[model samples]
Target: MQITKCLHTALLVADLARAEHFYGTVLDLPKAERPLNFLGAWYQVEDYQIHLIVAESVPADLVNSEKLGRNRHLAFSVTDLAAAKDQLLVHGCSIQMSASGRPALFTQDPDGNVIELGETQLA
Candidate 1:
């Protein structure tokens, strides 16, 4: 069967409240829904959602969770990269530029999850 869409993406965090503040308040992602049984919160972006899950411990197979790098990243296209970077900085998030230059900036969430914010450069 073919996959039509990505239902959600999950990130494990040590603290749910901090993750909620970062993803919900700092990143400005709208809350879709949260279940009491599930130890996570769903944050909606354009057509998809990022799920931040609180876990007591991280699995050994989680490579990205061990180290924050470029390989594992979530890229978001924005109208203004500079403005987005400024806002993220105000939230105390660290920013980095992509190899392509100033069109994009990379940063991490409260749990050190890499997120890329860039301007949609259409050819």
Candidate 2:
């Protein structure tokens, strides 16, 4: 069997409410069906879906600070990198550029999960 595509990506979040605000309200992902006992929410973006799972509690080390450059990150391809950066900034996200001269914006959800917004050149 051949691989088709990614169905969803699950992120462990400290606060389910915050994740819902960011991914649902900010990113504007449509609502997806979620299990009542799941303790988190799911958002749909085009074909793929993002599932935010609520963790036990917020880590003491990560409290009061935004997660930056952690080992894990999710990248979303956009049509306009600059526009995406501006939109993210408008939503109170901290945008950072990559060192490779390519346009990129970095932001974290309330749970300190890093979300990357970038674009690929069309052929």
Candidate 3:
């Protein structure tokens, strides 16, 4: 059987409230619908859903420094990389430009999940 649909991506966090604030405020991901018994938060991003699960301990170094340009990361397109970089800097976040020289920058969440925000291209 071939897998076709991917429903959601689940990420572990130390605190649910902190994760909520980080995602809700920083990334501006809207709170998606979840079952009442669910213990975590669900955020709707485009056609996908991000589920933040509360974990006792989160792993460190999820973002590799050496392979940043070639590493695993969640990428999103922004209108302006310079503006985004400045805004992220305001929040004390580090921005790493793509080693390939593309108009993109990388950062992470409170739990150290690697994220890349790239400038969108207009057709």
Candidate 4:
């Protein structure tokens, strides 16, 4: 089977409130309505979505970038890289710049899930 698009990615989180605050307040992603009996919440990530599900344990390998060069991070394209970087820092989020000469930076969520922010427009 061929995949046309990514509808969503499920991220297991330990704290729902903190994860919600990070995606909603810090990253400015709008919350999506999830059905009743669903054990998770959804957030609009640019054109796609991210699902935050409560989990008692997460694979440490998925959250560890030092071992794999951050190959498993979700990336977003923003209009302004500097502004996004500043906003993340204001929220007490540390950023790691991408060394490929592109306008990109990496940060983590409360659950240690890696997020990459890239500049959408060229200077």
Taken over the whole model, the C-alpha lDDT of each candidate is 0.77, 0.75, 0.82, 0.84
Tens digits of per-residue lDDT for model 3, 7-114: 788888888998888788877789998886857899997888888888899888544676565566778788888888888888787778888788998887888878
Tell me the lDDT of model 3 at 116.
88
Q: How accurate locally is residue 92 in candidate 1, as Cα lDDT from 0 to 100?
A: 86
> Sorted on TM-score, highest at the top, how do the candidates line up?
4, 3, 1, 2
Candidate 4: C-alpha lDDT: 0.84
Clashes of each: 0, 0, 0, 0
Off by over 4 Å in 2: 58-70, 121-123
Off by over 4 Å in 4: 62-69
TM-score of 1: 0.82
For candidate 1, write residues 27-84 as lDDT tens digits: 7889987766878889898789887878897543326533334457777788878788
Instruction: Supply the global lDDT for candidate 2.
Output: 0.75
- How high is the lDDT of residue 86 in model 2? 74
- The order of the candidates by lDDT, greatest first, is 4, 3, 1, 2
Work out candidate 2's RMSD over C-alphas.
3.6
Candidate 2, 1-123: lDDT as tens digits: 999899999888887777788888777678898876868888888889888878897553433234344336788877788787777778888766764566766777776677777787898
Shift in Å, residue 123, candidate 4? 11
User: Per-prediction TM-score, please?
Assistant: 0.82, 0.79, 0.84, 0.87
**Reference-based lDDT, residue 96, model 1:** 75
Candidate number with the higher lDDT (2 or 3): 3
Best by lDDT: 4
